[model samples]
Target: MSLHADALTTLRDWEAPDDEQEALRRRYLTHLERHPDGMLRAGRPDHVTASTLVLDAAGTSVLLTLHAKSGRWFQVGGHTEPEDATLAGAALREALEETGIARADLALDPVPLLLDAHHVPFCGPGENVHHLDVMFVAHAAASAAPSISEESLDLAWWPVDGLPDAELAPFVARALARRRHAGQAGSASGAAGSSSDGGGSSRAAADQPSR
Candidate 1:
């Protein structure tokens, strides 16, 4: 099977309640479900499949990474390592390590959304392909700053609307739409219940104090 077929077929059967709508992206989901303790990447390659989308306060700035190998500006994410026990856990670790941020203040949650697969010109002039991407909702401190790490050519946040027209052409825009939907859902849910963060419903329930 082709790479795309290999990815889509696996995604079609991914069994996770949280990913009902995103089950189609299961091909990109970590191959760790069979092994509860950690991910098994026996056949996985260096291509990144899933990621965490971390946006700033105004919901305008998006934190991006300049990958060590690809040098492409992408989200904080990578292939599932044998150590990753869960998708969300891997997303969080990737964000912290790649973006160089402390994990304490983040209220980031997971929202499994399938990123339409497509190949875009990468780096200088060699690698050109898009690994299937499973994007998740992530958060970073409004005050926390980004420092470019060795993995990136440069680290900077750009106005969500002002991303380079060329680079933001397809996949990036699709990823952004998911974040917008999640934020809107959070707002609507909050008004109906209570204001809180962690996974939304959990935060709302926690807001109710026992009296």
Candidate 2:
């Protein structure tokens, strides 16, 4: 299936974790239904964007980028490209591109972890655009090292409990909760196995631009 169709299917089938999220899900669905080009950056006032928060294999820290345009820390991600087959694929592509973390070192979750809608004043000339962002989570191998991309002013792994941006706390919490839940489920099914080791060490790469 095409990326647009895949996004529609994913959003339609997703079970939102809360009433607010459910509302946003419905809004996203409505936008896609109304605008066939909704997944593209050229879609205008509102478009779907994909992003991924990279966690250490140990789930104790997350990778964040310092956005050049916004001068704010955020997960690695950006606009969807036509080559992307699915929303998750788009997110993974962004993560790899922005973090410089090899695919072998990142284990991305196919399921989206959250959704966010926010205004981007720099997205267009003389107009503000809203990004309907679909967020995913990935776990980096213990030995994984991320290099900075041009899209970021800096790249760093911050402890989950010590995020540079307070606003990201909830998202990190949600991802960790999901991880624990999955682990428990695997254990209950007698399929538990060791996850890739994610070292808790914090490190930052030099500066770069925005999404």
Candidate 3:
């Protein structure tokens, strides 16, 4: 099946964790239906992108990259490549390439954690592009050191509750809140050993001129 079709299926099968997630999922599916090339970067009108929230082993902190273009800390992700077969695979690939996180060491929950529709600049002259982003959560050792990539100015781990001041995207706050909620619930369910599987911080920066 084509990647676009694959994306449709992925979104179709996923049971949204909340009303907001359900709305985003519906928007993504609608976009896909309207644009057959929606999954490709060259899709013109807009495209589907994948991102991941990299959490530490204890899930207390997250790894973020200071995007060279936006100059703000954002999750590691980018346009989907041809090798990507599924949305989750695309997310993992972007995370691995951008963060230098070993695939073997990262444990990704393939389900969608968050969905965001945001504007991205620099597509072409007088042309606006939007990214329907599918976000995921991955866990790695808290001690794992991320090797900075050319796409980022720096890489750092920020406390879930104590994030530094910067041009953070609005979606970042929402994603963080979901992560914290999941962590609290996970902690409460730890005694039972239940396997709990669990964006937007870059919208305005992507729209505005780089500082």
Candidate 4:
């Protein structure tokens, strides 16, 4: 199936992280149902954007880009391309391009760790846009270094424990929390079944914590 169709299918079946997220998911689904080109950049008011938070091998540090436009430190991600097979593919492609990481050295989780719906005012010429961002988690070897892309003002690694107060994107905290929970769950499950248990942990962590 096409990536757009695949996205629609994924959202249709996805167990959203909370009532708020579920409501947003339903809105995204409804938008897709009404607009066939909803996932594209030209989709106008709304579109799908994929982002990946790249962790070091130890999962303690995350690579962040100082987005040239927004001047904010955020994960690597962008709009979906026509050739992208899935949302995860789009996210990984963005990550590799933004971070200069070889696909061979990156380990990406296919299932998204977070879904964020937010607005971007400058995406178009005097047009307000809404992004239904699908967020994924990935890991690169500690030895791997990231190169700065023209899209970013700079690139650097930040410890999850000591992220700076103001530079982080809003989704960063939520994604990191989910990643930590998954890690802890896997550790508690022990090495023999850790892999399988880790999979379950992702689903459980996908649920947003009660506010």
Top candidate when judged by TM-score against the true structure: 2
User: In candidate 3, what are the lDDT values of residues 18-108, reduced to their tens digit?
Assistant: 7988998998899899987888888877889999888777656788898898777788898988888888888988898899977777766
- Judged by lDDT, which candidate is best? 2
* Worst lDDT 10-window in candidate 2: 202-211
Position 41, candidate 1: lDDT: 26
lDDT tens digits by residue: candidate 1, 188-209: 7776554444444523221221
Clashes of each: 4, 4, 1, 0
Superior candidate under lDDT, 1 versus 2: 2
Error of 4 at 60 (Å): 1.8
- Give candidate 4's error at residue 93 in angstroms: 0.4
Which segments of candidate 1 are over 4 A away from where they belong? 1-48, 116-130, 165-211
Model 3: residues with Cα > 4 Å off, grouped in runs: 165-211
Using all chains and alpha carbons, the TM-scores for the candidates as numbered come to: 0.61, 0.89, 0.77, 0.82
lDDT of 4: 0.79
Ranking by lDDT: 2, 4, 3, 1
How many angstroms is residue 158 displaced in model 1 relative to the true structure, after the best TM-score fit? 1.0
Better structure of 3 and 4 per lDDT: 4
> Which portions of model 2 show Cα errors greater than 4 Å?
191-211
Candidate 2: residue 137 lDDT (0-100): 87
**How do the residues 96-200 of candidate 4 rate in per-residue lDDT, one tens digit apiece?**
999998878887777776777888887885467988888888879767878999898999999877775443545566666766886666555555455666544
Per-residue lDDT for 105-207 in model 2, tens only? Answer: 9988878899999989999753768999999988899989899999889999999989998999999999998888776654543432223333232211100
TM-score, structure 2 vs. true: 0.89
